[model samples]
Target: MTDTILEVRDLRTSFFTENFEVKAVDGVNFSVPKGKTLGVVGESGSGKSITSLSILRLIQNPGKVVGGQVLFKGEDLLEKSEAQMRKIRGNKISMIFQEPMTSLNPVYTVGQQIGEAFQIHEKLNKKESIKRSVRC
Candidate 1:
């Protein structure tokens, strides 16, 4: 089996701002092998977030994944439907944002928020999810 867990080739993302089209990710390429981490380091407006959003197919209106092949586990994620992509997003591939405080909901308790991940991905019962979360 191939060692690559995720591969992004010639990935491109663009946004239309009234005046012109801005290419956030311009033909970027990288691969992450299994059991390894890939760090994207750059200044703001460097297309780091856009690249992740495209991988997740989470780009909003006026912004689009113009071109790319995002292969996860040998599957072409870019070619998958939204519903199909959703299944892979939090389950097969998970991401922790740079700022956990902002990523989390302030109103909910930490346990409650963490339990939601189990509920969504594992479909675990609330009690069991909470128990599992506490162990973490």
Candidate 2:
């Protein structure tokens, strides 16, 4: 059996404004197997970013996920509470922003920033986190 790591089903997200509503994402679906890579590609404004944001439950005010199921390891992320999602983000799943300059902190080195995840999720010390960060 192919081990399915992540699956997205019928995701729908919309932005609400006083004037009108914009359907940013609608009826998106995909699956990623374990130890595999999935790339999202589309023209600009084709709901690529919106679909990703909806999967991560990162849609902010004026925008909402209308429908969908985001399953990670067979667990429904769309049903998870905010606190639960916090534990999953970065630890279980992560997104590399398209622009590194904006995503990365100016003061910290790349290793320090990457190692921070190990410190938080794996409970490793600064020394160990830095050590592990460089190995990859």
Candidate 3:
């Protein structure tokens, strides 16, 4: 095997309302090997974003991942606690929102935002993170 980095099996997500439920993502399945990328393409509102959100466990109120497993490096992310997920997110994995304008804080420089990741994930001091960000 080439070493599977991520595997999503029977992934499902839904939005619940008072009267009905919208199956945003239903039975999605795929795998990506290490050093590979998976591109999900579809029409707008075809569950692409929902699938990504569910994988990251970012689904909020009214939206739930009702089923399936998101395996990252052979571990089930769905079974991880919220605190665990917090560490995994931004460190092990992240979502780059489609909207660039709203994704970052305009007040801060791009380098500052980028360095924050290193600070949080790698436990680097602010000075070290800034240096690393500059090199990138």
Estimate TM-scores for all models: 0.90, 0.92, 0.94
Q: Write the per-residue lDDT of candidate 1 for residues 1-136, one digit (tens) a residue.
A: 7799999999999999999999989999999999998998999989898899888898998999999799999888989988997788767877666677899888988888788888898999888889879997
lDDT of 2 at 3: 100
Candidate with maximal lDDT: 3
Off by over 4 Å in 1: 98-102
lDDT of 1 at 126: 85
Clashing pairs for predicted structure model 1, backbone only: none
Name the runs in model 3 displaced over 4 angstroms.
none
Give the CA lDDT, 0 to 100, for residue 57 in model 2: 89
Query: Residues 93-124, candidate 2, lDDT per residue (tens digit)?
Result: 88777678898999999989999989988999
Please write out the lDDT profile of model 3 over residues 36-56, one tens digit for every residue: 888989999999999999999
Question: lDDT scores for all predictions?
Answer: 0.88, 0.90, 0.93
Q: Model 2: how large is the Cα RMSD against the reference? A: 1.4
Alpha-carbon RMSD, each predicted model: 1.6, 1.4, 1.3
